[model samples]
Target chain A: MSTFGLWHYWVVIVLMMIGLYTVIARDNLVKKVMGLNLFQVSVIMFYVSMGKVEGGTAPIIPEQASGPVVYSNPLPHVLMLTAIVVGIATTAMALSLVVRIRETYGTTEEDEIRKLDRAEHE
Target chain B: MTFPIEAIVFLFLLATALAVTHLRDLFAAAMVFGVFSLLSAGLFTLMDAVDVAFTEAAVGAGISTVLILSTLALTDPREHQQPVRFAPVAVVLLVGAALVYGTLDMPYYGDPTAPIHKHVAPEYIEGAMTDFGIPNIVTNVLASYRGYDTLGETTVVLTATVGVMLLLGGLGGARHRGDAEVVEAAGDEEPTPMDRVQVARVSTTVLAPLIMLFGLYVQFHGDFGPGGGFQAGVIFASALILHGIVFGLSSLKRVVSPRFLEIGLAAGVLIYAGTGVASLFRDGTFLDYAVLDHHSAQHGRHLGILLVEAGVGITVTCAMVLIFFFFAGRRAAKSEEPGDRDRRVA
Candidate 1:
């Protein structure tokens, strides 16, 4: 593939990395969830990008077209819709877990939670 | 080569992602993330994924942002100062490089001969109109050809809501707290006074019903347009969420009733699964709508899709609303702690 052909994927890669970095590096639980959201959304963008046809319009079949229409693939779009919903569901669950963790540990920072866990064990 | 709109959207998305990462205030991060979702929705539109864009706009930008902001109500808005961690950065770099390298072998953007397009996608695109007489191929494939996957997805949504309910305690338990305590707790817990504004109340009053109507349109119009059960469910949930935000959780619970929501959640999943089982008893395969109408198989498919879509819409809507209720309830309960409130205010 040419350089122009691959730039989109590369940008998505950078985005995914940023999200991953945030999730791993952030001490706050909510920030971690936000990072996870970003990661998943970047992946969605990658899939949607691949489905785009050069000169194609939206995949909805026109009612009165005399010739074959160039339409972007709809499969990825359908799949990504499921992914998006699942992402939200998972994020909701994660946030709830964070709430419970806060209730128990009295802190949302990962390092403090870890410290508290170690103290309890010791 | 001409510039594509995707590049511009991606740039904005990248900037937003970075801002979300660097912002110490969780509230600002959440808002920036909403902007990020909106940009991605715009990009999805540019990519000709209108349904996904509509969904991203509603669910990602609208509901998730609201949920995250509500979550911030329970937790501290300021992120703790931590030293930059090198290990995660190194790991991220390695993984990102691997992904980039992997993409080298992938088909170029919009290449008609890409492997994804060469496979069953073409079959669905060509067969959708002939088999189901649905103009929107995505809906046809989601509800008919790949009905089982959608069914599984509905179940997942139901399962998540159940998990949230368990985490936040039973619906009946939440209701028994009474309105007075809930009102007081909401007043104590909520970070924003905006919910109390007359303007917000009036606007939400005007908009909630219209939003629900649009949700219905999206639900039934899936056959002809870029919407279906999933989008409709989120939109419907967003309506209730808006009401809850402006009118307070107590009023919303009074209107929706947690017990009714719980029933709605299960009913949605059962409706979806039952449709498939019904098809089986009629000597058709699971989720086969062709047997629904003996006169015309197309009509059967249409009926089956509509019923199953309704089931999906119901479950998703109920699940989202239930989750929000539990989250908000938990926040109210947490804020009731006298000592915790002092620390939270600080």
Candidate 2:
């Protein structure tokens, strides 16, 4: 097994767990969004890594290389194009929601907002 | 050669993300997020996905940072964050554990014998040179066989544009532009005009044209390499963004007004769909450009892809810039902090 191959997945897994920990344990709503962003990037990393081919060039064709050259699959890059767009959309939506929450509840703290909401409902 | 470089970039991105979550100050966290986004862009370049790197750099580092910071401007800088409930954590972990464990039979990263290459992609790559003049298989898929996907994605850009516009209350008063009252009350976070980083006059003179030429080169040269609409759009957007940061927004805005931007957005989508309509009139499918010039099947397809890819790049770049305004305008408004001001925002 190559060294990078052995370690990359494990590192991703550990980082994912840490992201989950941050998301679930954090009291702030923004931190949850931050954790969520971290989690999504890990997935992007996994997909991109999966598309890598052994001994692949930088996907930019060398002028001197002749016909029928080997290349890494370009599908993941295609797939990542969609993911990157979606990431921005989600971040915009999340921030918008944060703005709304701050405007309405006067506190971005999850527990505090819940209390304020309860007071309103009660 | 790549071992140390990749490791450092990866480590720095991971650290920046961690710092983003842990920072108490919202502005600080947002700035760190920008750093994370740029590192991720560097990582994408390292992975040989140049298009993705560009989008990530523009949208992630450039646009998304602006969005988050603007949201900060409208809301409180300091607020208590919620605690993680243990119950939800356990359930989420259980689900994730199941997903990972189920992947034991999956192909290892970059394995040549993987199922992905065995499917539709290889045919597109192998046949593109003969069937369509473009050498890049991904471009072929995006602009030809799956031209419809690109069309849909263009609509996605418009949809985000509409969403951001609506969220910002039509992009005029609630945020930055058209709101003179806002600028007066906004805080000290705005960097001074002198703080603006100018591209060296000589280097910009040399590099600006080169950057524009390269963007065109990538747009046209996708015929032989790993580039397409997505990368080209980012290259175009980044060139402007780089110029904007260095030279200032006033000059950039003069070159491309809001009305021009809106028209650019629609025009790109129209050309993309228009190509499909031309094919339809030729009695082929929506994006079937083969009949447009039946004498040379590959050349016809090439023309179709070139037009569509150019359109995609146009819409995406413009939409991305507009989105950046929706975000960054918030941080730009404040000449001074109104900590004592009683502005009960709703």
Candidate 3:
């Protein structure tokens, strides 16, 4: 396999990096959640890409096909389906936490919340 | 070579991810994130992972976007100003570089001899018809061979729901407070009169039931197609959410009470665990459904898979609906609290 064949993985990696950057750099709690979601989704893409066969079709068995059919590996898809649901669950939980933070701190900014906490402690 | 549709889609995904990161307006960012999910789903389909694509489309593109928008409604949409931080950038780059370096050792795309392809995946593909009698090998592997992992995943979802409820205050626990105050507050301050929109009402009324029907199809059709309990649950929840969006949260609550949903959340988990225990009664190992029926092992496995999948569907649907209710309720309560906005300004 040539380097060109691995272009998909490289692009997915770049997306993952962008998502990671957003999660780390962004101040808004919601944006951070969004960033985390992007990072997760890119990871899912990478896994699915690995499961792809060069000339394979979808994993579903056809009714009338007579010849041997190359079905893409279904294991990664199965695992990633679980991951996607888990991702949504986590995102919902995170967003709810953000809502609570906003309500309690009167702000969603991480730094402001920290400062408020410091003042309260003092 | 033909037009690189996958490459184009990947580029779109990258561009959308960047846009979502840089966009200041949270609402626009949420919309862009929806597009990002849609494009990723497209990419998943292109890669022949149709089940994942369906799930991504429903949960990622549909429900998450709505949830975020609802969150936006409750909180401020504008982001706070922050100075450029170099440390995070450096860390992200370092980790990303490490990940890239790691991928170099992985087998090339879809090589039949790849380690993953040579493992249990082939067994699933070859033995699905004989062992599980299911056409969809993905379903066979997920429901039977990997039944324990899926059970764990369901528990994780249930745990997350409990955490959300604990943080946001369970709806059943808070119901006695009289949501009248919250509803009145939302009415006064909410910018859009979404409930009063005739088109939304008409469209949702017409579409909601159809979505529920599709959800059912996806649920039972898992043995043959690219769907199962997870996708079905999200679709079902999305239908309820759409109804809530058009008819108002209060109406939705009256129709499907929080207490019922809360019970449902636990009941689904119980059902899943119960199936495993039931198998034990038949002198089978935990979650071993082959002994579920005496006549045939395949028949027993089918029954077991169906019951467990239904359990998963019920739990997921209830969890999602309950979470939405809690978030919406919290937002409403916050809006009603006097001097809340003033505190932020000060």
Candidate 4:
């Protein structure tokens, strides 16, 4: 349709929804972490898409140039580069927490862990 | 005669994300998630974010898959069947609708006149040659223009290492399986076909050092191309990880000691911040690269970016390696002695 540009964002939104749905609805902690990662990647995609220019090349300047060139916006790329690393750091931290939870409760399922906590309180 | 590869990649990304969420098999989901990461990296390349794509492929697709698989080894792989709850689904749909609405006013996919391109981006793009004299705009901006943010990100990597160490003790906790158990386990069962894949083992031995050499190249060549410390660090770590998996974690540890990695983890952040402090001593403000060299600002910027990026590469490599060790080590310790939580054998 005429709205092809907007369609990109709409698809990204759909991907984000899937991630959010998984995180909210899944009982498995590891699955939730997967959902979190999905969400982060989609968000990165959204930002990078904004930085795209129709006729632009990558942001690296050529050593030998024939004429002026169009480079896609580099700021978002820079920010998202750091974000990707941060996303992994967050994933590593969350997964380790999941491991600890499994150790303490003997199950990675949320409802089961909650039940154990509730029963322990009594 | 039009091939819409971008649209195809996006569709695959959606399908993979859906599969990751829908699958009850956690192992399969993690593997599919790796595919999803590669698809996303492909999309990043389509969007001209080759540097980001490089990082995503290395960190998101490669190291993330390895880490998740190691975690799955230590935990249950089957996600217990849960009745789908409509409440959360409804909530997610509502949030999605709001976000879609919010995008109604956002600039189109490749609108060159968008506000983002109008802002500081032009300055960075136009000034890349004159200001930093570096061909790679992202590296110049990431390592120089936004030095503080990267410094903070390095610290975050260190923080993740700290949190992991605290939650699951040091890599030293990963002691080798007892000699008797190893012999008995071998005697108990016929060897699987995977054990006989000497070709893969031989290939990995020949390839791992080459991968490290490539990582070093990416680390040093980032000033001119689509790679930097983050991608290179992961590449280096993955090489070691590959070696560990093929040869054995104990053998891996012998090659690169656990103590050395732990020190490298903190040392990366120290190197990063140390550069800024050194800049301050040179009569420059925090992270001001212009004052580092008395003769030329260009040389100073070059030196500063290189040093900070080196720090980033060191920290990220050690951090990824240590995280892998912790997860893989926990599995080893558990297999060694079931139900023994005290693995404080440093």
Candidate 5:
């Protein structure tokens, strides 16, 4: 764990790429969505992980006043909360779109849907 | 303390997501993505963003996955699709890379003693407590220091609502030629009445009201924990969506009317904008709510902020649900047609 600095950020970077790869390469629409979700989550982790204060405690105000309390910044957490909501809304919308796609194409395969779309366009 | 595992966890998450994306099998890929979302949420928790993580887990992993699956029902997984062109991708990558690299000179993450937290945030945290007697720091900052921003955020939701309504309400596209109807027309109608359109299960009906109550609690709970109008609005939307999902959209349509959603989005935004305008009447600065006569300057700040947040919550939640419905409505409308039954898929 002492070797956590450069390697940790690097790992997150790698994971983000993998998720992005899945989204790009996956032939399945569902899989593509999953990859996109992973990608979004990667960013969240990147932000949160960077928010650590060396000796920060929880961000709550305790009962005792005037006590010296070392705590992390609570703003990132708040920002993340909104992001999460946004993520959920995005998910719901994505799923709804997927459902529509499924209805039109009669299958969930990316290639087949594209082919059909092409045929329709042509 | 022992060595922190946050680094390792981050690495593992990154790996899982990469692996998930690389998988060939569509089903496995989606599941891996879900796990990736969960892991990232875990990372957020480690970083002290419990609320963000909670939402990531619930939405990123749960709702998003479900939606993707729904979309997959219409398309095939095996056919070879055209590759996305590389020119745009290259341009995007270059831009993104430049942006990330620019952050290198910035201070290290989580430096609580940085100029940002030190200069402005600490002042607000210390000031709000004595100023308004509220204990929550996030609430104070969001509502007071940046109350106007919160109002603007609410307006974004309202705008999204209008966008969604326009997207959903318009009757266009081969109006007489929706594919859903074509698929259904060929199939022999199945029994079980309303089973054609998949709805979320209703066994947990008892929990519906509780969820609404909890939404209120979360709205008010911003004074302490990681909550406020935004979280509360999402929670409220989730409850409404849950009802729509489980009981079927038809069931939900009866209670949460589309008209109501539209009106609520518009009204919520107007109220928020109106409040900021109202503050001007007190003969102070724009959003200079200090003179609004709430209690003291602190009280005015708190009250003004909360009201705006509430407006934001209302607009955002309504807008989100409406947007989802706009998309869902298409499928829902198709499903209503007897000929659209053939598209029932996962």
Candidate 6:
């Protein structure tokens, strides 16, 4: 019911759409990879956002504190760290595939590459 | 307290994402993507995910940009303009609406009473200090409680290195390290444009060592602060990457041979798994750190975490640097091809 409370999730959804649209519509292979990157990063942002606690600090424990210290959830950060590494791996693998495609067809446009493949088949 | 800053940052992230989607010039889009990553890293900071922010800024902003640019170098940079496709737009809208509808039932941002916060997180936050005695709960959880997951993640990085090498032909010129030409290229500097910048050369010579030193600090200092194997590995690899950029790949090959990287990529994963196997032999279950030390379980845990993190750092550093070499080297190899320059010019 409150816009202020749900605004962050709303913005993240919009960002995710921008990424997904680029992936679906863009012809350029590199740009498609970039779009995929954007989508993955936004998902990471969503998880980290969900982990935050109002008034909580980073999860590093302090030596001494006067009051009960509230720490943001550490689980998401840990999981997202792995997710980011995996993201880069996926990007590298995809880009390398694009490089191979370019070398074979001498072009990176999806439709152009498809046309070349069709001609080869014919 | 976070409303003004966090809201503005979120808005900027949205704007950047839009720009990245619309930019036709691939080079410009790649540059803007770097900016997008930095902005996202800043947003992560605002959310108190400092470690995640650090890794994102390094991997997303730094490594991804370099990889994309190199691919552009080997392939093309201009995105051919096509008519705005409404089908995708409609699809995205439908999906976004569904996602928003789904979010309505989700807990609000930063709500401590959310189901996630009430789950296993409290155990980690409390147990990290008493069980492992590490100040950084994230590290304790990532390195110990979830050690198997991290091992799998490190293997994924190694797998990536293998894939890129297979696709790009054996680390470019690195396989022929025995070639006198490559050795000569390493022995003496090639007069390239990057080499002409005395200030860059001098600064890089001075800064590369310092950056690697800081990487070491991050590697060891994760127990008390916001870093661990993944971030440290990327940081260290970046230092070598900087050296390669400033000094040329030939010189970098002399510093880190391709063979070293090939072995290093697998070595990291082995080190991680070896720790588990070692613990199994020591009468504890896999990855049980308490068995590592005879005197105290805490001491054993500290030692085990350190060893596992080092393994992760080594593998990551190798995988990243190897990927860079393969991509950049392909460009060199293609340019070396007869008539390739003429074809490019035409």
Off by over 4 Å in 3: B1-3, B170-192, B340-346
Q: Write the per-residue lDDT of candidate 3 for residues A7-103, one digit (tens) a residue.
A: 7788888999998998888888999999899899888988998898878887888777689989999989989998999888888899888876786
Candidate number with greatest DockQ: 4
- Determine which window of 10 residues in candidate 5 chain A has minimal summed lDDT: A1-10
lDDT tens digits by residue: candidate 1, B217-336: 999998898899999999999999888888777778778877788899999989989999999999999999999899999999999999999998998898888888877766776657
lDDT of 5 at B339: 60
The C-alpha RMSD of each candidate to the native structure, in angstroms, is: 3.3, 4.5, 3.0, 3.7, 5.7, 3.1
Number of the top candidate by lDDT?
Answer: 6
DockQ of every candidate: 0.64, 0.46, 0.69, 0.76, 0.39, 0.69
Please report, in order, the local distance difference test score of every candidate based on alpha carbons. Answer: 0.84, 0.67, 0.84, 0.85, 0.60, 0.86
Candidate 4 C-alpha lDDT tens digits along A49-82: 8898878989998889879899999999999999
Per-model tally of clashing residue pairs:
0, 14, 0, 0, 24, 0
**What is candidate 5's TM-score for chain B alone?**
0.77
TM-score of 5: 0.77
Give interface RMSD, every candidate, in order.
2.4, 3.5, 2.0, 1.5, 4.5, 2.3
Task: Pick the TM-score winner.
Answer: 6
**Chain A TM-scores of all predicted models:** 0.95, 0.85, 0.95, 0.96, 0.87, 0.95
Candidate 1 C-alpha error for residue B275, in Å:
0.6
- Candidate 5 per-residue C-alpha lDDT over B207-287 given as tens digits, one digit per residue, 9 for 90 to 100: 678878888887887777767777677667777767766655556666776667777887777776777787888876776
Task: Give native contacts recovered, as a fraction, per prediction.
Answer: 0.70, 0.42, 0.76, 0.85, 0.45, 0.82
Candidate 3's residue-wise lDDT over B34-103, tens digit each?
A: 8999999899999999989999998975789878987887678999777769999899889988988987
Candidate 6, A4-116: lDDT as tens digits: 78888889999899999999999999999999989998899999999999989999998886799999999999999988987897789999999887876788999998998
Off by over 4 Å in 2: A2-7, A20-29, A58-61, B1-13, B58-61, B77-85, B170-214, B239-253, B328-346
DockQ-based CAPRI category assigned to the predicted complex of candidate 3: medium
